[model samples]
Target: MELPEEHSLGAHRRVSEARHTISEILTRSQNEHFAKGNDLDFSYVSSEGGRFRVNVYRKDTGIGATFRSIPSEVPTLEKLALPPIVTKLCDFHQGMVLVTGSTGTGKSTTLAAMIDHLNQTRRLNIISLEDPIEFVHASKNSQVIQRELGTHIPSFAEGVRAAMREDPDVILVGELRDADTISMAMTAAETGHLVLGTLHTTSAVKTIDRVIDALPVEQREQTKSFLAQSLLAVVTQVLVRTPEGHGRRAICELLMMTKAIAKLIQTEQTHQIPSQLQMGRDLGMQLLDQALLAAITARTVDPDDAYTYALEKRAFQKYVTDTTMLSKLDSLAPAAPVPPTNSTD
Candidate 1:
């Protein structure tokens, strides 16, 4: 039997009630009625001043809701324990820096941290477009203006276009969910404003492909050209159980755009992108597999969990102590990459 208890991002309490009772609580807390066949995304503040990101959606069993506890203060890159190199991505005056991960993986927190860093260090105009604003930023060094979708604008595309005309030096898009928004972000980057955005992808290569694939066949080639010029880096994150099993930690794959990598993108040789990441340690790029391998080597993360998410499964095969589990993982792993052609064209 499914329990009435639901987990919030940071909260661990179990609330026992009927499903309808839970829905009523949500409606009362947010004061928004989500009609049938429609969903609502918004933030709620507790009587204690705690904030949570809430989502209510239609489900087969009736209305389903999920809540993610938002930290009152945004953490810094150092606080998140992300690499020092991550700070360099934020330092770029103009270009696109993409933070990508699956849902519930803290992509929002990473972007918030970057914005927080800018808030503490830089003097510029920072504009954010969120579905429903989560963390609130008060201007310290950089000026911040946060906008919500339903409350402030109709869509992220409109907000982005409007941001361009508003004299923003940095624009934060909560998600590059569609082609138009992604295209607008690239355009903004090309026009000399640093654009920080998120994508729902697993690796750096897939992140690049997602942008190109989202476009029409007629627009893809040109979009690649724009992306090749405007993309500064792609940081893909995966959360894994920490060594103590009491919390989670981010395993990251950072793809820093370089001349050779950019050429590979232009030539559409994206399969070779992983090879570039392997050779890019001095340049601050790393594959998800590499990060997983390190985490495994340090005994900071379980080998079994790392293998489950690894793109190149062979890297962690020897590290996994459970033969039965290794076999189980192999069954679910995708087919390996095709060998590169040696013939000169």
Candidate 2:
């Protein structure tokens, strides 16, 4: 079958290679079936040092396929270029650590990195429930039981409940998408299991709000209280093109729950949480713009890219400007004169 050529040469070559690999998988196994024919859905490691999640389907007279590339080797914290504050989440023994970002911002990669760290260094039973099983973990000091959503069980919520019975030390849920899944994850954390999950949100405050809003109005208050007690930290990230013009890097905003922050969440005063995060830098908390400014100053990301991802662009702009500009502005402003109203009074 003739496949449509991709626009870029790089993309075309990758697609061609993926197609060849898919064809091989379809023909090699007799037990595999797809679309009531010889087609099959399978995953394999690509020759280019990445993993592929493939779907083979029958089209107008031939077989067509789509492949999603997953990284072959799990990236380290340094390699992923995430903030140092993320490592702090690993210190928590049990609680919900949410890695939140918009789609395609490397949330899955970050989760995999954390799991890989625990798998290699710590002796624990790790249970992972993924939609399509993106990363394949090799058991080291820890044993990993990876359960694909459809292959192992029916849904994420069910898989999570089942994980509790499996006697796991760490549980990784692909996404906390619905209230059922979120509630299950919180329960797992509350029961002394370390729960790690991802969410589709851009800021820590919004992530907290999203979880609360996901529940019914009557349950919202109770849900917030549970979250305040079970939530450990919220890491929000965005990927930006590097200033070096080669690849992308992540800009992360970290929000670690303190007593004050927990009180704010319980009271439904989430807007104040961001300011608390900004003020609590000593506790590994940071606002999104602060991360962007740091990335810009380090030359790891382009100024324009940083500005684009910044939550408060004007504040970030002022932060990135030279001291001379601040000095000039200060000099141009008039000083206040002493008032005679007090003496007259």
Candidate 3:
């Protein structure tokens, strides 16, 4: 596939050279990561002294890999543009804190920031299980151990089980993609280990529902109870282009698991979460649409961008102030066709 203009390295050298380079990297990664099988789902590759998480696969054109550049220096929460509320999550002793969003929404970056905060402030064992291990954290006040999925272990479920034996004070499961992993993560939290995980869900309420619904029907009730007892907070973010068009900003929805929230999750009344979040302004909780409105009001994000990520498009329409964006919004609404122009035609 052709690379995007921004991430592209320009038309440097020949196409064959680029393909050859990518092929060689894949060969080395496969040999190092998968010695017994030919699967290449996820792997890490180092190029030009920088590490990248690569997803290698076959395309109709040829073998292709998508590269995500990992920053060498870990950024703090404030530097990453995360709300100040997220910093408190690092201070939680034991419970599951989830960073959730769609792909390319900076979930990994936010998790890295949280881990970095813990590394600087706490003297404890921190274990991380990632598919390719995006960020590398050095031991500071904390003892940090990062294990890759295929390199250090086989899967996240197995890794979480192993982390329990490692006597970890905190465990970061790269993602909670399945029932087994989610269950193990909750157990880890229940057993007094702070667990951080990521999910691909878009909103707080959906995230809670996703976790419960990921389990078997019989296991769901028990898992909901586990989640109700162990979940600390759910932070959902979406990246929006800045008004200046130079960089992107994170519009966040933060749900801190309060007493009422715990009851809601336990009783499986997740649909009422938005109303609770609206009333939780003093607790630093905000819905995704609220966050977007704040960004729009601050003039940092385009109104149309806010509308794109808003949960309720009709409700968010009132916030569009840009004339061009308003025109676009108007165009999207169904138009009433002129009644048959009888004799005028």
Tell me the tens digit of each residue's lDDT in model 1 across 1-345. 223334673222433344445556554424445644567788878778989987777655444677789989898888788877888777889999999999978898899999999888989999999978999999999899999887787899999999999999999999999989988888899998999999999889999999999988999788888778889999999988876777777889999988898889889999899999999999888988889898888888878778888877876788877799777876988899999989986
Candidate 1 RMSD computed on C-alpha atoms after optimal superposition onto the true structure: 7.1
Tens digits of lDDT, candidate 2, 1-79: 3354557888678666856756565543323444247555556566566778766665553346677777778888878
Candidates 1 and 2 compared by TM-score, better number:
1
Q: Among all windows of ten consecutive residues in candidate 2, which has the lowest summed lDDT?
A: 27-36
Worst 10 residues of 3 by lDDT: 3-12
Q: What TM-scores do the predictions have?
A: 0.86, 0.78, 0.86
Please identify which of the two predictions, 1 or 2, would achieve the higher lDDT against the true structure: 1
Candidate 1 to truth, TM = 0.86
Tally clashing residue pairs in candidate 1. Answer: 0
